[model samples]
Target: MLRKNILLYFLYIVSSIILLFGLGYTKNWENKDIIVGFIFLGCYIFGTKYRFTSIILLVTFSVLSFYFPTGIIYGKPTEAILISLIQTNKLEVIGYLMAIKYEIFLSVLFIIIQFLIYQITKKEKNKFKYFTIFAFIFLYIVSLFGISVNHHGINRNAFLKNSIDSWKVIRKQKEEQRINLGDSSAIKIDGKIDNNDDTEIRVVIIGESVRRDYMSVYGYPNNTTPFLNSAKGIFIDGLVSAGPNTQLSLTRTLFKAIPTENKIHWGINVVSLANKAGYETYWISNQGANGWGDDVFYNLSKLATQNKFLKAGDFNSGNNDDEEMLPILEKIINSNAKEKVIFMHMIGSHEPVCSRIGNFTPNFKLHNEAGCYAATIEKLDLFIEKITKILKGKKYKLMYFSDHGLSVEKTEVFHNNNIVEEYEVPLFYLDSDIKEQIHIKKKISGLNLLDIFSSFINIKSNVTDSNYNFHQASKITDNSDPIIYWDEYRPFSTIQKKQPPIKDIQSNIIGDTVKLENNYKFSKECVSYVDSVDVAFPLNKEVYKIYGWAAADKDKKPLDEAIGVFIMKNNQIYFIQGDKQARNGVRDHFNISPGERDDYGIVSFVDKKYVDSIKNTYLGYKDQYNQYHICIRNNQF
Candidate 1:
């Protein structure tokens, strides 16, 4: 009887664990399902003859369920089930729903174990079965730890870590303020009140992945940025980056806490600071509104006199064009308002670079990386020009910068190839006739954009102690002394500073940028480089960092693995290796110039085999870093 009951208890544990694993697959977890499963198991285990063993099994299963991933713990099971059921047929829905029922059925099986345990171990207190209960506890802890370790940024543990750190910083700042002032704590970041200028407006356009490297207005080969080049404003060159990802880059850009001296991860956002300054704050975005302080942004927008927080699409599958967002802009500009800071967050050249615009093939003559990017930039440029023209007489000072630079290619993964082109971004400030009246002071970087709000407003206010909220704008373009972060596998700032001139010329020549039906000129250097490493190249560097490409290589041939070279000329990124330069070279793909050979180089052609073979090599550091290094043969080419 005791043996039968123990077996039944063990079976229950196994079934519950299987259910837990299946539930975790949804990526979103529901607490209610676990509870239901637990209740069913408890009911079944009560029938076991070894009553103590049955009770212990029931408790262990219940406790283990609580250790579900954060998302599962926070999410609603019913809602998840309903969502999963959407668009499914009756039979499919029944099958899916049947799985949930089976979880309960397995729990009932525990009752058979309890009956047997009671019959066999009736004379005993069931001391041996307690070990299994302890095992469950240990397994729960180990399993959770393993899950957290495997998943870096998105883990509940990591999010909690950041949140707790932010709260601690906020508390410490509050204490410091009290010590400084007995009566009241003044806003530290915000300066003295200036009543001199009543009518002031600022338009901040935050571009997504708009690097200066490919901008025609900035002297690229193509005429991508014709509008910006002709426009009237001060074009600031040599803008540097604080980090790569959007959350880190945007947090540094918006929060006031100085990111130059130390890294600030958690702080009150600049939007809140702007609100306290009595200026109308508005956030118009072309992306999801809920990521890192989205709640804070929403709250600030609500406090403002006018709030227009438009999400271009839904949380999951809804798709909206960036250009289509112009309708909302037209309304905001035409509306009645005074002293407003309008933040326009554009999806300016974000990838699936091809899907940014509706038409896959807008122009027949246009094809290739530069051309595709040029098309997108041209579209955005036209939009900007139109917006500037509309705000003709409006009192506004416009500051435009990208969240972070994106590697020019879609297939190119960040962090996989640590290159300057992946990190370098564009920064520009355009002041309309109205903004000229208020003289701007202090040298500002996008890194300090969030922290400098009080300074931007030129008013009195409280500054939050949270560094996460403070924009690390001051570090923008501070390449002389570059700041490194987790995502950057190896330091890349040095690459931007060093490298020879011959590499620069070699990088400039365009390779097979676009292989259209029409003929296009292929650079001689690109052809020669691809030919040399087509079959054999000796590996000199086991692991290395890629800088930039001399040119782009779009050739559809597999080339031998070669070390990617990095060089900076006139403060922009360029790549070259030995006598050959990468024409369509992608940093994420071992800086391999685009082309073909038996042995594919760093950047290979995407196909069924390529997609199927894809796998992550290195482990990410803290805070969700995907950047990695590569093994390269360097002695021969």
Candidate 2:
């Protein structure tokens, strides 16, 4: 009876697990997934005394369902998903959650089933009597230390290890900041220095999140780069960036990047090299450090003689415009240093685009994110134009290049580096001596940034002189080397090729921006506010964002496109078509179906643009049938 009962109990436990964990995967099961699933099973079966651990594991596995991939835990240093999660800001986290709400819903249900199985197997505690406490300890030891040794950053135990390793990178980078990077002997680099007898200035403008295909100068339909389009310079075509993200790309671009199996060795950087060559270097930036403070750009920024970080946080919030550093630029340019190398890091365009626009406003009507993207490049053009004014009559050589380009897809525009557009960035150099624009017929890799920059600055070195000669552009312009893909570090050409299409934004915003004074009228019965308007900032007399529930009252069915936000600016009508955004009270107020979307919620950025133009702005909306109706409780603020 004892032998028969034991066999039955063992069968029950096996059957319960097969039923619970098996149902989670409907089809194709990966080996890694099965291994992870079994690991969880082992923990639950062994910990009979602590049966409640199953509840904790259920939550953990559910979260890991979203995170567990081949590369996240044990991938390349900066490109790991875990590293990205650590680097992300609050707004980015919010945006990503909203984008993947459906995936999150499914993951919750999967892990709950595993928790229920623990209750079913609770009566099997008698099975644990044969095994001593040492068995449980041995099982946990193998799971923790043994798995961690095999999979340093991939296993469950190695998650903490990966996070700690990332911070170690941060700590290691912080240590680099302590050294006198500006001192020539500190770096101990072998390079020839030419002390210019006359006054001279060297400017390196590092642009943010800009792709070559999006620029007007590069045949883009939009006039996003009007100033650069006419500017006389050595423009290189098909210039690939070092890496996709700022840290990975710039660490390799600005510094001597050696990608070893263990880690990326950030050797002597260009700023330190410049310092070694006897140039008074200054790093003035509108770009923020990695995760508010980390290895991101802080390591390279510290190498300069004089450095100042402009943006306070991740540079995802507010307007951290390039113009903010212009005052400092003027100070540096007018300084008594005979030879100066100024590195200006501009926040050209980071993700969540609307926040970055200072002088240039986002035209939401013509593609919200794309318009903001174009505006950032336009702002950069104006910045360069202003820079030319600052350096007027001064002996100066200017060079500009972006850290990396953004993804072409609208939904996820950041650098996972899965597309060709992500690597396609701008690289150019111009000096007072150049009379006409000389487009380098051949392509080049941005990994050669150190060499190209050194050559442009007339740095006497065998590396620079051998690879490129700025003066003799025609015969010896064969510096085109192959670039490697991000993370993979394989030949970039081997990856799938995808070129971004020309996204022609608002024609006016692209060309000379002039507001159309449209005579758009609104009838009083269109939109109704509940109480006083829910203007975001009422205290400072700033009324930009107005929130209220709107509906296609005439239409029986609420198509998402039926609702809209109408703005009357300069006595002209501008309407932004509605998309699905949920407000808690919207469905209840409208008495809509649970299956139907919450289309009634309305929001607009009327004050996102020039404040004076929006001074007399009246907020209203037009329904799908072109019937214009004004809000009864209108924006009187």
Judged by lDDT, which candidate is best? Answer: 2
Point out where model 1 deviates above 4 Å. Answer: 1-200, 257-267, 291-304, 312-317, 359-364, 410-417, 434-446, 451-479, 487-637
Residue-level lDDT of model 1, residues 1-637, one tens digit each, is 6776577576556454443442342344455445434533443444233455446544554443432322232232322122223322222233333223213322333333334444544464534465555544443433332223455422232222433454565456435423322222233445544455554567777787666666656666656677777666655455555555454456456644353454332334555556556667777766554432243334334444555544622223345666656677667766766567777777667653444555533322332233445456667777788777767777656677776655453222112113566456666656564222221222233554553444445554455322211122333333344443422222444435221111121122221111122221222323112212110101111112221122223453433333232222333322233222233222212322213322323322111111111121110011123111122222222
lDDT of 2 by residue, 502-560 (tens): 47554222111123343345554444342213322222123344445544444423334
Q: Model 2: number of clashes? A: 3
Total colliding residue pairs, candidate 1: 70
Candidate 1's TM-score reads 0.48
Task: Rate residue 597 of model 2 by lDDT.
Answer: 65
Model 1 misses residue 236 by how many Å? 1.9
| Model 2 residue 450 lDDT score | 76
